[model samples]
Structure formats: structure tokens, C-alpha cells
Target: MKYLILGAGPAGLTFANMLLSSGEDDFLVIEKENSAGGLCRSCMVDGSPFDIGGGHFLDVRDPDVTKFVFGFLHEDEWDRYERDSRIDLYGDIIGSPIEANIWQLPDKKQERFLHHIAEAGCNRGEPMPEKFTDWIEWKLGLAIAEDYMLPYNRKMFGEDLDSLGTYWLEKLPNVSYEETKRSCAEHRPYGTQPGHAKFFYPHSYGYGEAFIRMASALGDRIHYNEPVFSIDYDNRIVNGKYSADKIIVTIPWTGVREHIGLPGKLTDSIGKLRYSSVVIEYVPENMDTKAHWIYYPDPKLSYHRILVRHNFCPGSKGYWTETNLTRFDEDKAAEEGRTYFVNEYAYPLNTIGKQELMKELLEYTASKNIYGLGRWGEWQHYNSDVVIRRAMELSIN
Candidate 1:
């Protein structure tokens, strides 16, 4: 094979398709699982489709990226909807970013949150804190931070929220005292919409259906149930089987250490990579909620968020809960008898030195015929569109 791809996820499969589209086909896509689709894989349960890797929808932010993603499925096969995401705040349901939607809350509650926003550090011209925990307080004030941001992030990123850096916050919606107050005064949404504000989903299948179609298009070019047990990077050989001129690794760097042959220093550094894990559990929901997904910030709840699958997916009156792997209850999950999928490397953490470390490792690998791509490969918490666009760009280069 001229090229060897080490995963069948969004990054790997997209790269494979791009290669084929360019009239180049001497490549093999290897997936450790018996099937393709990687973490985005979906399964059927009593006529309902479950996204085992958690809720992944085609983001409509980038026209080019969305166009490329829409190519796999026909127009009639997909459905688009404006995002109606909600937040559960201490028994009260309101729009997300309590700062902007404070008007929806009770009069007293609205007045209190407005006061909190007024006293926020961002309004006082205070410097942003370095830690995620303190930054939350500084960015949105102590009230909203404690009420929603802090506890919700604790459920999402685990107990020591301080360990996380503030770099990733740039991607999230930024709240300011002026916009927030104006929003509350006028009862309108402020700032930008979160990802999937307007998105697409498959009509009859889960979000993974398009990737499955992409995999099917590749035919024999994809190798299933094949793990790269050992890689001879010196010779560009994989498991003593096939040799390729270049290899693209889309798996987590932490998991790839044992399978790769690298210097002790490089391998040890790879082991130090930090990431978060999540367990997705699907359950039946007879309630017909208009919201596509709801965020739970209460520390009492195990799940940080739940996707109303019935709203987006067809033929199913169910929802899926996402919990941090540390808090997931196996017994309860088994009792639910619903679908449960665990991904050990869910969100790559933006630690103190993660950027520098990834830069060094990627530079080293590129020098050798091995390259890292996508979320795990690049250790970036990128959405599907960004991952696919990166893959497409790499294929062209």
C-alpha cells in the first residue's frame, strides 16, 4: 500500500475518501474494531438509533465542511433543525448561558443573576485567571459560576477543574456584562450560538450512518478487526504485513505508545498525555421535549448532559445520557438494560504544556513517515467538521 491509515474514525475515513476522490487508491484503512465508524459508530436498539460515542451531529458552521459531509448522504436522507438546547438550573428549565437568558427566570432570580453579571471580573477589568476554575468565576462571576459553570464543568472535566488551562475557553461562548445586561433588558439572546446551533442529522439512522456509507464506499480498501500490534517506523511496515510510504495515525497518542517503536524519551512523553473519558448510556424517554439536548449542572446528577434522541432521531422515543467515566455506575447502567458505550480517550485535555508537547511529537512524527491527525492524533478537542476538513487538506497536500 502507498499509504496506511491507522483508524476508521472521521479523520481516517475522510482522508481515505479524499484519496479515492483524487484518483489515488493504493491505501488501506485499518480499524481495530470489526466494523468502521470509530467512536461515531451507531447501533440499533428496538428501532431506535444510538450514537454510542455520545452526541455527534454535523456542525453547519463551515459551508465547505458541511458540503463535504453532506456528500455522503442524499438530500432526502438528512434532516436539518435549528438547535433548541436547554439548561436545567436547580429545578428550573431555561435557555443556556444563564447570563443571556436571565430574563426567563423568576424576577428575583433574574435580578440576582444580573447583579452577579455586573460584579463579574470581566466587567471590572480584572485580568483573566490562568486556571479554568478561577477563570469561570472571573468570566461569569461567582453566582453563575457556582450555579452552573463550575458544577457543570466539574461533572464534565472531573473534580480538579483548576488543572485545566484557560486556552480552550476561547471556543466557548463569551459573556460580557454589556451584552448580558442588554439581553436581559430586551429579553433577547446575546453573543454567538454554541456549536450545532443549526445542524443536520440522518432521517432513518444515527449520525454515524454517513460514515458507514463512507466506509462502504471504500470496499476492500478498509481492513477490519486489524490492530497495528507492532509498527516498524524505520521501514514503514505495519505488523509485518504491509509496507506503506507514509502512515497516518488517528488513534490517541497515549494508546499508540505500546504499538509504536520510538525512542524511550518520546514514548515516555506520549504516556504523559492527559485526556478525559466518558460513558454514554441510552435510555427510553416517553416525554416529548422540544429541546434537542439539555445540560445538567447540578452536582447531584451523574450525567452532565442528555441528548433528546427522540427529537432528532426518527422512529425512537429515547434519550442518551453522557457521564464522566469516573462517575459512571456500571450496575445502574446494566440495570437500565440500555446501550452503554465507553470511550477512554474522549476529550483531550489542554494542560499546561500540552500544546508544546504535541508540537514536538507531531514534528518528530512528520519527519518520520508517520503523521498525527484529528482529535486523538492531534490531541485537540476538535469537532467533526474541523477534523474532516483537516483530513481533506492533508490529502491534498
Candidate 2:
């Protein structure tokens, strides 16, 4: 084959699809699982489709992304939704980007939230902090940070917030104090919308359906149930069997480092990469809320968030919970008798030196005609749209 792509997830598949669309057909894809979609795959829980890899919806922020994805599955295959995401603040149901919906809170709480936002360093023109923990207080103020972001992040990340870097946090909602106050008075979203403010989902199937269709279109090019057992990166060889002139790896670099010979320290940094895991537990009981998802920041809660699956999954019922795989929750593991999916590699952490470390690793691999792509490959917490966009962009080049 001319090119060998590893891990048939969104990244690998998109790259291959782009190649075919451009009339280049000498590439091959190898997947570790029998099915495609990787983390985008869904499982059937009592008939309702559950995304075992956690909540994934396509963000149409980029028209090109919409065009590429819709190419595989028709536009009619999706149901568009204005994001009905909420925050569970104490016992209150606050609309997401809490600052924009504080008006829904009691008068006292509203006044207190405004006070906090008004005094936030960002509102006062102070420099943003570098550490994720410190940045929260600086951007949203101590009150909001303490009340929600900090505790919620602490639970989701299950790590010292100081260790995470701020390079990737631009994904957070960028609400200004003026827009926030206007939103409170106007009772609607205002200012820079958070990602997925309006998004699309599969009409009848889980989000994975689109990817599965894309994989099917590729036919025998996708080698399912066959994984990259080993690689000789220097020689552009996979499993000591398939050889290609160029390779794109979408798998986690942590595992790839071992098979490929690299300077020991670079390999060490790849191994030392930190990540967060998620346990997606599907509950058959439906939640009595219109929200597609709700963020629960309370450390007391067993799960950080709950997906109101029935609301978004067409005819599906029941909800699923996303819990960080921290030791705290492992000991708990929901006393209820529902089997759960444990994804050992979930969100890749952008901690401290991770960006620089991955850069060096990718640069060295490129020299050997090997490339890394997707979430684990880039070691960034990229959503599906971004992942697909990057893969397509890479393919066209």
C-alpha cells in the first residue's frame, strides 16, 4: 500500500475517505476492533443506543466539516438541536455558561453571581493565569470558580488542576460581563456562544452511525479486527507484515512509542503522558428533564454528568452517567445493577509540557515517514468535528 493509516477512528477514516474522494486509492486502514468509529461507537442498552465513549455530537461551527460529514450520511440523517445543556448548581437548575442564566436563580444568588463576575480579573483587565486552576478564578472570579468550575473540573480531571496547561482551554465559553448582564435581563443566550450551542445528531441511530456508514463505503480498505501489533517506524513497516511508504497513526502515542525505535527520552515522555478516563454507565430509567445533558459539579455526586439520552436519542429512553475514573468513584461504581463501559483512554490531558512533548515526538516520527493524528495521537481533547477537519486537511495536503 502507498499509505498505512492506524486506528480506524474518525481521524483515520476521514483521512482515508478524503484520499478516495480525491481518486487516490493506494491506501489501507487497520483497526483494532471489528467495528469502526472507535470512541464514537455506540452500544445498545435495553434498545436505547448509548454512546459508550461518552457524549459525542457534531459541532457545525465549520461549514466544511458539515459538508464532509453530511457527504457520508445525508443531511436528513441528522436532527439539529439548540444545545439544551444545563448545570446543577446546588439544587438549582441553571442554564449552561452559568453567567448567562443567573437571572434564573433567586434574587440573592443573582446578585452574588453578578458581584463575582464583576470582580473577576478578566473583567478588570488583568492578565490571564497560566495554570488551569488559577485561570478559572481569573476568568470567572473566585465565587463562580469555587461554586462550580473548580470542584467540577477537579472531579472530571481527577488530578491537581495546577498540572494542566491552559493552551487548550480556549474551547471554554467566552462570555463578556456586558453580554452576561444582558442575557440575565433578556433571558436568552448572548455573546460568544459555547461550542455546540447548536449541533446535530443522528436521527435514529447513535452518532456512530455516520462513521459506520463512512467505514462501509470504504469496503475492504478497512482491516477490522486487526490491530497494529508492532511497527518499525524507521523502516515504515507495520506488524513486520504490511509495509507502506507513509503511515498515519491515530492510536494513543503511549502505546506506539514502544514498537517504534526512538530516542529513549522521547519515548519516555510519550509513556509519561497523562490522561483522564471515563466510565459511561447507562441507566434504563429516563430523566425527567428536557436537557440532553447536565453537568453535575458536586463532588458528592457519584457522576460528574448525566446524559438525558431519551431527549436526544429519538425513541430511546433512560440516561447515562459519565464519571471520571478516579479511585474515589472506582470504589463506589454505582450500587445499581447496571453494567458499564470503562474507557481506559478518554480525554487526553494538556498538562504542563504536554504540547511541547508531543511536538518533539511528532517531529521525530515525521522524519521516519510516520504521522500521528486524532485525539490520542495529538494528545489533545479535540471534539469529533475538529478531529475530522484535521484529518481531511491533512489528506488534501
Candidate 3:
């Protein structure tokens, strides 16, 4: 069957790659931007490469996904490194997988924190938590929920804890009391951390270079700068020009439903989905940070995380920091002598009832032979690896 893919990002590219491997050639990839990569796209400032969308790292735990991604780049084209990630909390640099390193806090505070966790462990039979706030307290106890989880998430999400869903917890690691005590006693933290403990980065070009290479493999299949303003679902035509028997959309879900003229019920469900925009600040490469990225849990700071890009690859020539904000003042950043790039829809919100709504939307679209793909397209918070794997799974099924 003829196929139309709405984006050339990771998900779209992965799906297209799968089709090519299967000898399915009747397909086209339509990208709105002048290039590929979607949110993972790259840009340059002052001759320094910066991932303006935020820091993109390869730390996926899935072996198949790893092999697939690495197939696009040569061995010499990339380098591997252990994660030098830390958190800047209360002006102290704590090893990341924060829960595992909580012992680094002051002795008095650590005792109190462990006491709360002990209490929480004693009450393990409590009912399941429905909201994000309750889930944090239930999982990590009141102390961690108050000191770290609540405020940090509030800043990142730009919303109250109660308004969000607990599914985003998948991105976080869960540490137990025994794990923490052992880590503390041994003076070595993060023994049980999942992915990101070790990762890889490209030796040349921007983070989007991998996706660009994948697009290059397809040769003339991708049509860049083709902004799809409207999609006629009834006739299965995009912008009144391209027609296909099946359409796979990797674009953000917000505009697609309206463009296709879906009914009010589905539109209402689409409207409830929320997103967080990001502002990436460019700084000197020599910034005083040995860590690849540092998380700021303090509410006083405007930015939640600062990524030291140079640390990831010493030849990159600069650093980029990311923060979620409703509004980013360019003048203020300029006044502070900083250059920045704003990326709208940098993160997907897992607000209450979001899972159900996304399921309903996917089902309705699938019935019409239209599939949603990727982080934004699926309206879920998925990492790059998961996005590619999902695309491959969809192509096969």
C-alpha cells in the first residue's frame, strides 16, 4: 500500500527505515522544517554546535534499539563515556539517581529523611496513589517528596503535582532504604541505577546527525519544507496534493486532529492534552562544570537543569542549559549576557486522564488507517529508544 509519513524525526525515520528494509518502496516522508530531527534537531551559535532542543544522549537499555541506532554511525564516528551526571541541590553537587545518593546530604537532614522513609516503608500496604503528588509521597516518602520531587517537578512541568499523572514516574528510578544505606556505607552511590549510567555521543556534527544519516539512506523519499496545513481525512489526501492508502503521523497531536476535521468529542479530548516549552541557554564551553548535566532543585533558579555540552564531547566548543517556562524573556537573557533558543512543545504532559485520552485517540485514528508515532505524536513521554522501538513494532504489526 502507498504510505505517507508526516514527519522525518526519529519515529518517522525509524518507521520509514523499517519499511525500506522490508522492500516496501511506495512511501514518502513530509517534513515541515527545512531539515529532519524534529525536537532532536541541531543548530549552531558562534561556530559552536548546540542542541537547541535540549541535550540528546544515547543511553537506551534495549540491545536491539542500540544496535539499530549504532548501525547509522561508524565506530570512529562516536565515543562512549560513563555518565558524569550530578544534581545541584542546596548548592551542593550530589551524584545523580538522586535517591541513591541522598546520603550525601548533611547528617542531620539524612537522619530525618531516612526516618520518614522508614515510616513510609512501615506503611507499605497503603492504597495506590492516583495523583503524581500522592505517588511521590507513597514511593519515596514525605521528606523526599517535599525536598525534591514536588518542587522540581512543579518547575519542570509548569503545573501543580495534582494536575499530572503518575505514569511519568517511569522516567525516574526507584531506590529502597537498604540500597541507600548500603550505598552510603560504601561511600559509592548509584550501584542500582538503570540506563544513563553509561552513554554515547557523536564525535562529529550535531546530535541530529544520526537521524540525518538515516534520512540520507532513504535518498529522495523525504520532502523537506513541506508544511502540511490541512489534511483531508475523508479523501486521505494531505494538503490536497499527496494521497495515500495509509498515513503515519509523527507530528505533534494538537494540530493534526483539527486539520483532519475530526468530530467535537475527539477534539475535546485532544484539547485536554498539555505540554511544556523549553528555553535553551548557550554559555561558554569553559563553564566550571565537570558533570555532563546538573539538575537544579532550588525554586529560586529560573532554569531547572544546566547541560554542559562540552563535557559530553570536549570538542563541541560550548554548553547549553534547558529550562521549562511559560514565557522566556529574550531581553533578560541578553541583559544577562546569554544567548538562547526557545523550543515550544519540548515536553509532553501526562496530565490526569491523559493515558485514557491518548488511547481513545490512537484507536480512533487506527480505525482510519492513520497511526500516531513518536513522543509528541503519541502524546506520551517516551525517550528516543522507546520511540524508535515503538515505530519498528508498529511497522511490523
Highest lDDT, which number? 2
TM-score, cand. 3: 0.92
lDDT score for residue 345 of model 1: 73
**What lDDT would each prediction earn against the true structure?**
0.84, 0.85, 0.80
Best by TM-score: 1
Give the clash count for each candidate. Answer: 0, 0, 0
Q: What is candidate 2's lDDT per residue for 1-397, written digit by digit as tens?
A: 8999998889999999999999989999998888999899986778878898999899978999999999988899899999999999988998887767777887788777778788888889898888898888888877789989899988888858899888777666654677767767777766555789999988888888888988988999989888676878778888888899999989887665346677788878877799888899887887889998999988889689998999998888888899887733554555655668888888887789988899998999899988889998888888989999999889877
Q: How far is candidate 2 from the true structure (C-alpha RMSD, Å)?
A: 2.2
Candidate 3 lDDT tens digits, 1-397: 3999999989999999999999999999999888888877777776756786888887757878888888897656777878878878777678886777877887777777777776663246677578778888888888888878787887788856688877767555544677767766676765576567777778766678888889999999999999777776666788879999999988887755345656668778878888889998887757787888888878888788888877876566567777775546777888998888788778888888888998998888788788889897798778788899999899999
Weakest 10 consecutive residues of candidate 1 by summed lDDT: 253-262
Ranking by TM-score: 1, 2, 3
Comparison by TM-score, 1 against 3, better one: 1
- Give the TM-score of each candidate: 0.95, 0.93, 0.92
lDDT of 3: 0.80
Tens digits of per-residue lDDT for model 1, 1-397: 7899999999999999999999999999998888888878899865888888899888778887877877888767889999898899988899875666777887788777878878878779998778888888888888889899899988987887777788878655556777767777888877766668798888998888989989998999998988767677677777788789999989886765254467777777787788889999877655567888899999889999999988888768878899999999888778967578898878888887788888888898888879999999999988888999999999999
The segments of candidate 2 whose C-alpha lies over 4 angstroms from its true place after superposition are: 170-189, 327-336
Model 2, CA-based lDDT: 0.85
